[model samples]
Target: MSELYDLTIVGGGPAGLYAAFYAGMRDMKVKLIEGKEVLGGFLHHYAEKTIWDVGGIPPLRCEQLIERLSAQARTFDPTILLGRRVDTLERLERGAYRLRTDDGQSHDTRTILVAVGRGITEMTKLDIRGADRYELTNLHYTVQNPESYRGKRVLISGGGNSAVDWANELVGIAREVIVVHRRPEFGAMERSVARMLEMADVRTPYVLRELHGSGDAIRAVTIGHADDEEEGTGIERIDVDAVVVSHGYTRSYGDLLAWGLEIGQHGVRVSDQTATNLPGIFAAGDCATYANKVKLIAGAFTDAVLAVNSAMRHIDAEAPGMAYVSSHNEKFREMNKRLKRPL
Candidate 1:
């Protein structure tokens, strides 16, 4: 709502949140705009899921890690605008930048950190007939709870990491688990694919072509080869209780590319300092590309620290020191006590 800020980060994920916090360390007023309803971003979907790769933390659940990261990010209380999509960015005649959002909200900032990971693309849809009717009702794109499918026949579609992971997790809870994929071979990671293939209670290689049944709940599904040209005869119908679709995702770059920002196939290109080709603008996280950039959560934190430092320097011209403590200090007591050590 305000007209200006020292920094405005266009995401609320690890990169954006960390940027806000690091910027705050330099005493800069910051705002983080997250397009989603929640602050954790993709991690919110697998809140109970454990993360093993983070350096110091020993496999904490996605939710726990997010909560701890969020606590540290919010230490300086940056303005967090959830469910707001950044629609456009315009350069002002006087040298500031205006960030416009879908909800008609705008902010003028001296520097912008674009950490909007993957650019707001939604989960892929199943695209089967009759699926639209049940999308918000019975058919779901996300697995909200495994208990909801207890003792019920469920079909999960996709051969990707998310689909395979969900199928592996639901084997014990659902009465039956059927995983359908378009391709003959699953494109998921080796470990997940192996686990899904080994699940005795789950079925695989079934591709959904249509939906059957009516009313409040699903009854069955029609299947066929993803490459099948025939419509009806090659189709096989199977009885089921619920359908979970996890096809994958696409980036939503929209007009940002045409608006003059340098973009690659995955995202915008940036320097090591997170500076994009455009002056006073920077990008980080999944929406950024640079030498030595890594897409992991841990990597994003480093990107945030560097991006914030660069943004502050852009504003002050001669800002002192790194925005965040480059080295952890022994005397800097218990601020991130909630952070769990790696196992």
Candidate 2:
């Protein structure tokens, strides 16, 4: 017989991970499935980065926050499946749910939590002329590791926050940091913009027109005006070692809707109590869209608690629907001690 869990939380970001932890607190059998190579979701990309908000927690680095959250999740010891995408979902006659992955793996669970944030998608690639030849080797859409370009000449494209942020991050590390933005004004944070102005190597009002390089590596990039219509004009070339493109991302919802799961624009539409349209199913996190939207990480934690509590109540019919409130001070005391910060 195939083992079945009481709850299956998809998307191991803040939502899914927190949901898994909360489900465990309710003494429910939990399975967490994440589509990424590792846990932490988007926050993983900026691991070393600092975060100001997250309830009572002090300004913590992204990696520290992820580590703390992961530790909390492990307290319950969930059946975690990393680097696996849940491609399909279907309800069975016995009131159970079936989940299928891209690799033909399947699992059965009683309740479902769809927490796939921003859908599962990759960023758009730089399709410059002759750029495809050395894409994998020399060019990248996302900065997987900034340290990889240390002491090397790097050219980054795009005017968005990510592109500018990378330029700021790679300033001291890379040999020369060149940013090519199509518009005269950058679309990043003011602090980043101000910092970028200090680095004169970054070029504005310029667009990357073409890429020229040989096998396995990029040598230089062709730039032109943002107003140029047909091809490149006022074309200037700059030599570089690597090119990183940070245009934007493309969202992919996998096949949740195709597999009979209800998905809304904000994510999975649920009630004030986190109950979804489907019976025995709930959702939380960036993917969930309740009547009132709470997209913050702290909000996801609260929603997960509510959803798991509600799911447990549904499983145990005799259980009362009283609001979950802790009157005791022990919980807060313990939280303070463990987190090393006041609750």
Whose lDDT is greatest here?
A: 2
Model 1 misplaced regions, further than 4 Å:
45-48, 129-138, 147-150, 198-206, 227-230, 324-343
> Model 1, 52-99: lDDT tens per residue?
998888888788888888887887889988888887888876567988
Give candidate 1's whole-model lDDT: 0.79
Error of 1 at 155 (Å): 1.4
Which pairs of residues have clashing backbones in candidate 1? 56-342, 57-341, 57-342, 58-341, 58-342, 58-343
Residue 102 error, candidate 1, Å: 2.1
TM-score of each: 0.84, 0.81
- Superposed on all Cα atoms, model 2 deviates from the true structure by an RMSD in Å of 4.3
Query: What's the lDDT for candidate 2?
Result: 0.80
Question: Global lDDT of each model?
Answer: 0.79, 0.80
- Residue 50 shift from truth in candidate 2, angstroms: 0.7
